[model samples]
Target: MNPLIQGLATIILGVGGCIGYFYASNLLLDKVLYPAKGPNIASNIRRANIIRPWLFIFPALLVLTVYLAYPVVGSAYRSLFNRSGDEFIALGNYVALLESPEFRRSFLNNALWAIFVPVMSVTAGLIAAQLSDTLKWGNIAKSLIFMPMAISFVGASLIWKFVYAVDSDIGLINAVLAGLFGAGPIDVIQIPFWNNFFLMFILVWIQTGFAMVILSAALRGIPEETIEAAILDGANPFQIFFRIKMPQIFSTIVVVWTTITVASLKIFDIVYAMTGGNFGTEILPSYMMSFMFRDDGRATSVALVIMIIVLPVMISNIRQAQKELR
Candidate 1:
């Protein structure tokens, strides 16, 4: 059979099966569980009662267990075994990961990213949001500032790659530096700790727009009467921002911070595209991918490491969501 035809057949069958199952289930429920009375029914015949809403939730719970919960448990099991999936290696992979200098470096780089990217991105976004809020052409300023978010991470990295290209005439950064300092073109990605900073700048650039959009909406949500009251009480602009507006949107600030933190934790595309995790710029995700082909155990260990690193922020975000629900 043709591969395309087989693929189409599979999709059609899957859709038909789902539709048929839903239709049959509804028919069965209506006929057997919730049947209507007819004119010939006995007067003393008891009607069936509907089950509680929680009983109706069982199918969704089962689906989640099969799709989400099972996979997580299976991955955790796989992380314990070696590449062959036969021999149990216990914590050997994790131990090697911790003891290896390269892994350590990746951990430190990821740690730096987690710390700096969120803080800098949210800070820049907050400042931009505040400034744009007070400006007459706020929408125009916001549209320009938020334009970078429209670019994918890979595209942004490619764009910045040009900015950091080695040629003094072509790369904007080197061009500006060469004109000023009369120095030769330098490779930005090869510059040790500074390269991490360069890679982080891309994330900050992309995420600042995200932070701005969220924080700006939060800023606009602040009541006008509160700001006027603060002004009447002799509060200056700084005081109004810090004392009045900041308090009102503190939860939103936390949400933006955690959101950016989670994104920075899983950041792989920018670093991968820009440097391929070279020159001491390897974060956890990129470093993990390097081990994938050579050693599956080590790669899975690194995957678990990323999961551990991200778990806290995920929990915090969940808690924030719960609080918001209340």
Candidate 2:
């Protein structure tokens, strides 16, 4: 059979099956319960009628169990073993990770990311959003600021790679520094500790737009009446921003902080593209990938570490979303 024809047949069958199931289930329910409605009903019959829909839900639940829940459990189990997939090493992978210097540096880098990226990005975004809000050309400013977010992390890394290029003429940073300070071209990625900061700046550049858009929306949601009242009370511009606007959007601040924090935790592309996790720039995800050919134990440990690091922030975000929904 032709692939397109097969695909169309499969889709039609799926639609037909779903329609048949609904039609049959409704018919069964009507015959068994709906036609027998009475002034008084037994509790068991009422319960059974209520639970009839659950029969239809069972297939979806099973699918989720297989696809989502099982894989998580299976991955956790696989992490307990070594690369051979035979020996049960228990927490040996984790123990090795804790003692490894490379893993330690990766952990430290991730911690820096969780702290620095969110703070810097959110701060830059907040400042940009505030400034843009007041400007007549605010839309143009926002478009330019947001342009970076449209670029892939790898693409952004390549763009910055030229900016930090080693040759004075080839790299923008080197050219500017050479002209202004009479200094030689610098290989920014090769610099220790600080190179991580440089790599993180790319992420900050990309994520700042996301932070700004969310924050700008929140800023717009602020009531005109509140600002007027603050003005009537003789509040200065700084006072209105700090005392009134900031407080109203405090929850949004938390949301943006955690959102960036989560992205930072899983960051891989910029570091991988610019440095290949070299020069002490490895974070958890890239470090985990390094073990793909060699030590499965260490790699799994890194994966678990990433999971553990992200779990708390994920939970907090969930709770915040729930609160917002309420």
Candidate 3:
């Protein structure tokens, strides 16, 4: 079958299958199990209503089990083995990971990312949101700022590679430096401890727009009465923004912070694309990929560690979102 035709057929079959299932289930409830024609019609309707919700929820439950639950469980089980999965060495992979210097470096880089990316992105976003709202061409400015978000992480990393290239002729920063001061070309991504920050800036550049859009809506949602009262009380612009505005939208800030924190924790593409986990830029996901051909046990063990770290931050984001809804 042609690929496009196959896709269309799959869509049609999926829709048709869902319609058929619902129709058949309801028909069975009405005609066979709970007939409306009987003396117990009211009780039968009530019973059918109770079962109907579960029927609707069953598909979603199955998908969650297959996609989400199964992967976590499978990874956990796979981690309790030798490199080739021949013999059982429960928790040995994890113990090795704890002691490995490379793993420690990756963990430290990830920790720095978790702390630095969210904070910088949100701060830059807040500044952009505040400053842009006052300009006539603010939407245009926002569009340009957000343009990076549309680029894939690998594409963005590749683009930035040119800017950070070792050649002064090709790299933007080196060209400026060589033009002005006759300085030598520097590989920005190769500086050991500080190179982490240079890579993190890529994520920040991509995520800043996301943070801006969310925080912009939150800023717009702030009650005008409070701003008016603050102004009447002779609060400075800084005071109103920090004391009044920030307090009002602190929860939204936290939600944005946690959302970016989750992204930073799972960061892989930029590091992998730019440095291939070399020069001390190996975050957890990139580090995990380093074991792809060597061992399943070590790879899965690293993945489980990532899941454990992300779970709490994800739950906190969910809870904060729920609080927003309330």
Per-model clash counts, in order, read: 0, 0, 0
Regions more than 4 Å wrong, model 1: 1-21, 38-67, 323-326
TM-score of each: 0.87, 0.83, 0.93
lDDT (Cα, tens digit) per residue for candidate 1, span 38-70: 662333133322342334565678899998778
Model 3 lDDT, residue 312, Cα? 91
Better of 1 and 2 by TM-score: 1
Give the higher-TM-score candidate: 1 or 3.
3
Clashing pairs in 2: none
In angstroms, give how far residue 315 of model 1 lies from its true place: 2.6
Q: What's model 3's overall lDDT? A: 0.92
Which tens-of-lDDT digit does each residue in 1-326 have in candidate 3? 89999999999999999888878988898789988778998999899889988878787889999999899999999999989999999899999999999999999999999999999999999999998888999999888888898999999998899999989888998999999999988889988799999999999999999999889889999999999999999999999999999999998898899889999988799999989999988999999999977999999999999999988986876786799799
Q: Give one digit per residue, the lDDT tens place, for model 2 in 1-326.
A: 99999999999998998888877876776566553456544664576578677867966888899987786677688889987879999988888888889889989989999999999999999999999999999989999999998999999999999899999878989999999999887898998899999999999999999999999999999999999999999999999999999999898998899889989988788888999988889999899988876877667677777888888986877887799799
Clashing pairs in 1: none
Distance from true location, Cα of 286 in model 1, Å: 0.7
Q: Superposing all C-alpha atoms, what RMSD in Å does each candidate have to the true structure?
A: 3.6, 3.8, 2.1
Which run of 10 residues does model 1 get worst, by summed lDDT? 40-49
